[model samples]
Target: MRKTEKIFEVKDFPYPHVIVKDFLDESTLDLVIDALAGLEYDFKESDLFSYWASIELTDIDHPAINILRDDLGDEVWRKKVAKAFGSKSLSSIDMAAYVYGLGDFLLPHDDQVEERIIAYSLHLTPEITEEMGGSLQIFDVDNNNSKLIDSIIPEYNSLIMFEVSKHSWHQVGEILQDIQRLTVTGWYHG
Candidate 1:
């Protein structure tokens, strides 16, 4: 179950972002992860990204996915997330599970799409290491020059969220080892 009193601390610099650790209780997270593992994913690739992703979670007919979608779409949860980012509304959300195996990566780009106010990634991997190389990289761009500023390891059960803007540049680093960087990600729309 989602925590009712969970506090969202929005941070400035490199664009507005927030990271909530252990967003889901241990048992609930484990169940969600197990449910995700049971779903089928299709390999998707392009110049910008490469990974295996499932269909939208909302459209899935599974118990865990339904629970996750319902919780994320809850009025209280939506309001809390929206208020944290100073957003007017999180009336809708789009979610999907992603699996990044060895050699998979996503190039840098801001998630600027129609009405997407907040972008989020919920990491579900049981374990990870620096050498595995599936880290989320945040970039800083000034005067048309881009520089890598931060590389965040995919810590288990952590949820990362950021406001989608022209400057919210980020990417998923290539997976170097035999590890699956699994995450449920999407956007909260206004």
Candidate 2:
């Protein structure tokens, strides 16, 4: 397991965000991926949106869930995130693992739920390319027009965090390949 000191922020976009590389060691990453592979996923799809599969991380006793929760909830880690994103103290973490295969997509929406301060995604997908179409698209909103400002490709052992606000409109692009786009994503609430 690698420590959390290497995390860094990226402020050159629609909103301030943090990107942490090498979030976990090779062995731990493999363990987490294996655990997720064994868990059953609920297919979430609708005309309004599409989510291929998801498994909530509500089982605190599960080893992979425990590891992620512990790291995200750690005081040091929280403080670093808070300072980097200019947010208040984060009080709670709610998360789930998502697997997006071919045709899976999520429409643009701001994650402005009450009490939620920050949103994060720990990318677990490997060998993803720009053409694969499972990118996190951040939008810039102006006069009811939302334009694409950035698109982040999901990379293995990388974490992306952003402030949750009305202008924080984003989407997960449709998957075009047979590969799975895996991510452990959720919000930090105040």
Candidate 3:
């Protein structure tokens, strides 16, 4: 048997996963929010102006997505994620932005694809409260166990990365009143 030298260690989150936080600086986060907020007037009224950004999927070469990967690929973020996965290979990387009055709620589902992906959600909201109901539920499909990962009454800049697979069935609770669920989520491609 070959003895493997493990540098990164994957975590067993409630849904059989792992996570990494605080991948961006406050100033950078501010800049991103500013850029994202500028698009409000351009979008339709139904889109509701709040604040959020997402890593473009279809346009694999989108400029904004390039920026996200450039920023996130920084040594700091990479090292942290490497330590978590106990490996350096990441399959999916994306960013999403959300602000006040986001109407839709993410329903329970698993990320199924031929290629496995690691799910990631970065936090930019300055504050989040339990009643806001933006918590994420990760179900242990195998054991039927579950975990409610609450969003922090967040600070300036924080990121959450996780190992998500087909079994990673998850959902987002509803947002109460008029609030935001500002976050970025994506999966690895490898």
Candidate 4:
């Protein structure tokens, strides 16, 4: 579906979030993917996660980067997204490219960080599958304890946006296949 035709509604299960399939048109997606392919990623690993990540896209001087920044920064688009998530304000955005290879994974955590009102991911892995893992897993939280609730398969051209709060606990499942699970993820800041 074209982005302009998409109706954003938050789903209650697992947490308040919105999934927009076919989020980008073919031409735009191709440009973005090509831009991402030119980026240099660093193999980042920590106690919580392991993946190859490119530096923030905002500082890059690519045409596709400019397109993304402008689109996400557009006042109307920002308002639409903020309203869907019931956020009062969305003043800025931060984005980076990520590649999760075999055995790569991220542990669960609520994306409760400075000024973050919403967290989002735009999946670019066209050949990824549930059996290959790298799914976005949402957790059910009760009394500070979290349990797996749902696993969203990363589909090409799909965009996932969710409210970022204490209850917004999620993680990236390990990648079982020897393939790259590509994504451009970031947050809308209040």
Candidate 5:
């Protein structure tokens, strides 16, 4: 089924989250990905904590990016997200495009901030597999003793959104293959 016809699947394991496959139509997804590929990205590496290529979308003027930001900021989508995560104050959206190549990884961290209520990632990598190794790993928050709870593979046109709190600790596993693990990630501020 198309994303328009499918309801978001709610999952409550290590935390409350939702996953939506085929989040955008093929044409739109293609446009977004193409736009992302054309942008200049900066390599970011922070010792053992994080490493990736990223491009901020705040000042970009591309049509596809604009459309995506508008959709994400729309009241309808925000309402759906708010209801799904049981939050009534999801208000603003901030985003950036990321590319995780070989050896790139993000360490476990909770996305808790004063205003951030929801965190989301829209995967745009094509033909990714488990062997590629750039998966989103969620952990059971146990202070300094967190344990792995789940690992979600990066699937093309798939979206994952979760409530941002002290317990929402997660990480991106290192990419073992020489391929791009691209995604649009952001947070909805309360």
Candidate 6:
């Protein structure tokens, strides 16, 4: 079934967030999933079905949808993301993929890195039941000074957009089932 579009600009959200109307077309997402199914990464061991993923853009011929290579970084998404982050300009963008486990979870941390990064995650895993438990938890660094970022669940063919910099603390919740969570993690440049 096709995933219906949902309201991304919720008034309850503290941080500036915006979900792309058509971030990834179904064909593109499907292609990504197919590529992922045949990928091989011998990194560290994950407690759950989760796996740490990092692929170079050159590996894939699809410039429209790629990861890690500098060529796939489009200005359109960068500009939009920069505005959301309240930044003047965007220096670069990087793409990566995540395959989290059903019971895998990450600690609360910020995406504050070398550049002003606006992050966006596109879910590709189909039929994600609530039991999957791989939700992206974003904290509000302002209002809840102590803590409070929204925990957005991983819905099929959906996008969760946010600004990433030195202060954005976010994490992925654990999945409690035997399903694989796939996502396209985009990072913007300063």
Displacement of residue 134 (Cα, Å) in model 5 is 0.6
Runs in model 1 lying further than 4 Å from the true structure: none
lDDT against the true structure, each candidate? 0.87, 0.82, 0.52, 0.87, 0.82, 0.61
User: Would you estimate the TM-scores of all the predictions?
Assistant: 0.95, 0.93, 0.67, 0.95, 0.93, 0.74
lDDT of 3 by residue, 82-155 (tens): 55665556534444455434444556677676555466665556677667766666665655555544333333
The model with the greater TM-score, 1 or 2, is 1
Q: After superposition, how far is residue 35 of candidate 5 from its true place, in Å?
A: 0.6
Better of 2 and 6 by lDDT: 2
Distance from true position, residue 82, model 5, in Å?
0.3
Clash totals for all candidate models: 0, 0, 18, 0, 0, 12
Report the error of model 3 at residue 22, Å: 3.1
Residue range 1-190, candidate 5, lDDT tens digits? 1245344667887888877888887877778888888888887878655455556686778898888887666677887788877787677798998888888899888888889888999899889999999899999977688889889997888888888888899999999999988999999988
Which residues of candidate 6, in runs, are more than 4 Å off? 1-13, 45-50, 58-72, 141-145, 165-167
Query: Residue 145 of model 5: what lDDT?
Result: 88
Error of 2 at 57 (Å): 0.8
What are the clashing pairs of model 2?
A: none
Q: Looking at model 4, report the run of 10 residues with the lowest lDDT sum.
A: 1-10
lDDT string for model 1 (1-190, tens) is 7643474678877888888887787777777988998989999999999999998898877877877886666788888888898888888889999999999999999999999999999888877987899888998888799999889887998888889999999999999998889999999998
TM-score of 1: 0.95
List of clashing residue pairs for candidate 1: none
Question: How high a TM-score does candidate 2 get?
Answer: 0.93
**Candidate 2 per-residue lDDT over residues 68-146, each given as its tens digit:** 6777766778777887787898877888888888999998999899998989998998889979999999999986988
Off by over 4 Å in 5: 5-9
Angstrom error of the Cα, residue 16, model 2: value is 1.6
10 residues in a row with least lDDT, candidate 5: 1-10
